[model samples]
Target: MPTLPISLVIITYNEAGHIARCLDSVPFAAEKIVVDSGSTDDTVAIATRHGAKVVQQPWLGFGPQRNFATTQATHDWILVLDADEYLSPELAAELERRLPTVMAGAAAVGILRRSTYYMGAPMRWYRPMVGERMARLYHRGRARWADVRVHESLRWEGSTVDFAAPFHHLHNPTLVHKQLKVLRYAELKCRDWLEKGKPVRMWQLPLVFIAAFLKDYLLRLAFLDGWRGFAVAHTAATYAAYKRLRYFEMRRNPDSVALAQAELIRYRLER
Candidate 1:
């Protein structure tokens, strides 16, 4: 049989609940590489059991870890994935069939990401105004992950292809877990603003919140998802509120700057 030429790479940190399924969804890739950030759980075992090569490393932020995983892959065409994300069957098939021809010189491919959680519930309102679509497949030596601490993505060195088949991101379900994600993401942005000594305005917070809500709820058609859309919009509002409130707290307690810096340090350490 002709060999597959693309590799699927993922960076993980204690993603035991969803790693197996994510790896299982893209068996056609030439290789599956898992770079685990010292997962205490059976995440490493799980990846290996599913025929993926597992490498261990300390957390080093999102992009760096992904780049680290790329080192272990032998193939020229690479597909980067998250432990909680998977390939939709239709899209996977399409990629499998088109990649080699596309990979001949294609710089990168942007695949749609249709995310769900809480039992496949689509949280339309909470999703990003511009949802994330990772540049997964790209020729080796031509693509690399950026160095951003969060939401880092691949830097494709050539032209791009946009696929209609959406990747699936199964986010954590519990309300508390979801809120924590909001808090983590918000806290990061708040700290980013504080370090830069960005000025805060009384009206700006509410405006930003409203803008995010309108973009996601009204513009993104969150209404189509029913309750999920409402939940997402509400969560987005909560995140905006958290960012502003945290910003206020930092300004009021100048000493908290040290605390925020420490949290960022810990986050980078755990990445």
Candidate 2:
């Protein structure tokens, strides 16, 4: 196999169901590294068996963990993928064909991420809800992950080009999984806001939820997908509301911070 001068870096917890498929999809990676924050499931063993160098580290916030993973890579060019996301065959082939030019000049490459919901339908129009174009493939020297708890992204000053194809996101396999994910993300975002001393705008909670729903369903054209669109848009709006609610709770009752931290740790260890 002709490999690109790129290293694939993935961060995982209890992703036994998705890790192997993600690893197998990127044969063009010159190196593959999985940084696991103590998965009680078979994530570590499975990743190691699939030709990834597994590194066991305690959980840091998302951005820091990803930046740490980049340090473990053998190549300066980095390809970041979540445990549940994998490159499509067309996307992978496109990367192999264009990456050399990308590495020579571009700061990073952004690819469209098409997600599959719990009901198993691949969404055609959820871009506004999730910012479908993501800067996943980049050079470590030119771009790095932002230091945020939730919604961490790549930060770079140079120009980024978009790829023609999209990668697949096997998002939230079940209802329970989706619920837990929202809660976990809400808590993390709450903590980030608290640390920054940002006050919760009480009036914006309901307004934000409404805006998120309309953005997803109407502006993004998710309504074209019928019930599936409604469900995903509702979920996005719920997440927006829950995140603010979590912030208000933690800010008003400082004592709850300890409980929230414990819950987060438990979720990471057990999930």
Identify the candidate with maximal TM-score. Answer: 2
CA deviation > 4 Å runs, candidate 1:
1-3, 113-119, 122-134, 194-197, 251-254, 257-271
Query: Per-residue alpha-carbon lDDT of model 1 for 120-175, expressed as tens digits?
Result: 56454444522555567666577788764566767766678777777787766677
* Per-prediction TM-score: 0.83, 0.93
Whole-structure CA lDDT of model 1: 0.74
Clashes of each: 4, 0
Indicate the TM-score of model 1: 0.83
lDDT per residue as tens, model 2, 1-271 = 7998899999998889999999999999989999999888999999999999999888788999999999999999888999899888998898888888888885555555554544675766666433377788888888888888768988886877788777788777776788887888788888889889997798998899999999888988878878878987899999999888888998899889888778767756222
True-vs-predicted CA distance for residue 238, candidate 1, Å: 1.9
Candidate 2 lDDT (Cα, whole model)?
Answer: 0.83
